[model samples]
Target: MALRRTAYHYYERRLVATLPAERLPRHVGVIADGHRRFAREMTDGEYRASYEAGMRKLEELIEWCAELGIGAVTAWVLSTENLARPAAELDPYFEVLTDLFHRLPRVAQRLHFTLTVSGSLDLLPPDLALAAKAAADQTDGIAAPTMTVNIALCYGGRQEVVDAARSLVADLVAEGVAPEDLPERIDAEGLARNLYAADLPDTDLVIRTSGESRLSGFLLWQSAFAEFAFVDPYWPAFRKVDLLRALRDFTRRERRFGK
Candidate 1:
């Protein structure tokens, strides 16, 4: 049976209201997938419209956290694998990212949220990198209910680990240390500290849009015990209600810490 929009909305709202703000996760990670697909289904205009709407929804989510007194919100803006997309698709995405690079600071200022991009930034074009830097620098003054919004650009979990390992090995080689003795300093903590968003706290919750249930290698190590809430709505179609559902899911979860 086809579900009516009203009924779906009601269910989403009910899910949100049943969970208290006190049950909100301290750190939330969002995988904004299916944007390109959403754009394909709709016209170009609709695609851009959805992207803008998703961005606004992100603003609302961070505000939700600030209002609920949650700590951090990490968003998956792009993935390492996404860089391999065809040129036609890549062109538009790069444009959107460039626009977002400059626009995020203003958004953050309006919400007083801190801005940052995680992952291997070296993969981005020089101009885009500069814009990302600008956005990050503009938000150093947000004081009340400090919130961090991390955008994962050219980010991958397993790759990050491999890169970190390579770096550690390179440093050891430079120091004339034997390779066999590297484990003493190359522990999990060391590997974590070298990650793109290594400074951010571990994720408490991960939200993936577009009905996808898999992590897609978002935050491999950091989300070791993170709670997950998958949404059927596309990135552009997602709303505050979807975020509320994610929060509510976090509330009902029983985190056992792998006991």
Candidate 2:
């Protein structure tokens, strides 16, 4: 076991060394998937344990991104669709999520990153929403942060687009624009400006774990030209080597950005 661990570390170091800093992604998006399946398969349906492990893995992912000098990371921790699950299945997960939010501010401070929770907070349970907001507030005052972290809780890409459109319409109305002129005022760039994390760069790469090969509405607009890497491990089991491998693959791609 010790020998295998040593070999693994050596390989990881080599992989990191091979990646060109200039080729690394400026922004990364993660769809942290398969926690429930992992619980059923590995922990005999102990969901809280699986959730806790997944959250820990997320913290590790942030550290890894920071070390690589990635400018921003957007992680989808919970989705609007996920809220439809039975309370028995979701309550424990919510508890785990709330705990994660409580703990994340300290992590953000230590890592020198500004944290933002981007999602429909109105859709989440009151306590969970409050906890997430508090965490964001705690990290908002960081000065000249080294990186930015976005936690997508209760988020749905399509909903985000709809919200952005509504916001644009409201702004146009407030500006006293006539209804006919609204069509001309509304464009892709206009909608982009109203998105949840409008200030962040477009996603450069999106990583989804648990062998899923589809985006499923994650970062629907922002990832219009992002590369993807789908790995087989569940979120809880995702490793540093897995992330390194994804980064290596991203660096090899020739991105044309829709050209």
Candidate 3:
């Protein structure tokens, strides 16, 4: 099984590399879905392997983008709806993601990628927020390529827009600003500044695993023109080859931006 998987991964990369430069996308996003179902399908030892392997697979995607000179990469680590998952499972889920968030600084240190998170802060427990913030700040002084690692937690693009508008309206009202003057005071760029990924690049591609077809309200506004790829493999079974396959598939599409 291991050998077969390894060979498949190699073949996928080769397929992607064969694409013309003009076929490639500049940015990529991943929806890492379905860890628990994978765990259930495996024995005790195999379960651990799948979990760890999935993580390394995620790292490989990041490394691949950096090597290919892709502009940015985003991962849908957690969605706003995911917060409502069963409490029994939620604790451990939070633990695993937060652990990754904290260790991301080390990965950034080695990979030269800047990391950022976009979502509702109200949804995250305080400590996880601190860990996320710390990891984000560590990149401040380091010089790296324009690689960006975006993690979405409690993030809904529509919700984000609503929140930004709400906050801006509150502030403007407090300042005694008139309603007629609002458009002149706050434009689209100003609204974007209030978004979770305000400073990050808009997405160019979004890959969702586990046979899911919808964005589930992901970085919606930012993903306006992003190429969407749905892979049949579940998140835990997700591999580097699948990522390359997604890229290869993306390469075949003509992103005209409505001409």
Q: lDDT for model 2, please.
A: 0.95
Score every model by TM-score. Answer: 0.85, 0.98, 0.86
lDDT of 2 at 59: 97
* Full-model lDDT for every candidate: 0.78, 0.95, 0.76
Model 2: per-residue lDDT, tens digit, 91-180? 999999999999999999899999899999998889999999999999989877999999999999999999999999999989999999
Poorest 10 consecutive residues by lDDT, candidate 1: 43-52
Worst 10 residues of 2 by lDDT: 135-144
- Winner of 2 and 3 under TM-score: 2
Which candidate, 1 or 3, has the higher TM-score? Answer: 3
Predictions: Cα RMSD each: 3.8, 0.8, 2.9
Candidate 3 stretches greater than 4 Å from native: 1-6, 43-54, 167-177, 183-187
Residue 94 accuracy (lDDT) in model 3: 66
The model with the greatest lDDT is: 2
For residue 38, model 1's alpha carbon misses the true position, in angstroms, by 1.5
Per-residue CA lDDT of candidate 1, range 1-259, in tens? 3567778778866775687767778789999887777777775645555566666666666776676667788888778788887776666667677887787777777777788787787888888878887888888776762778888878898987788788777777789888788778677877777777777889999999998899999888889999889999888777777777678768888899799
Residue-level error in angstroms, candidate 3, position 51: 5.6
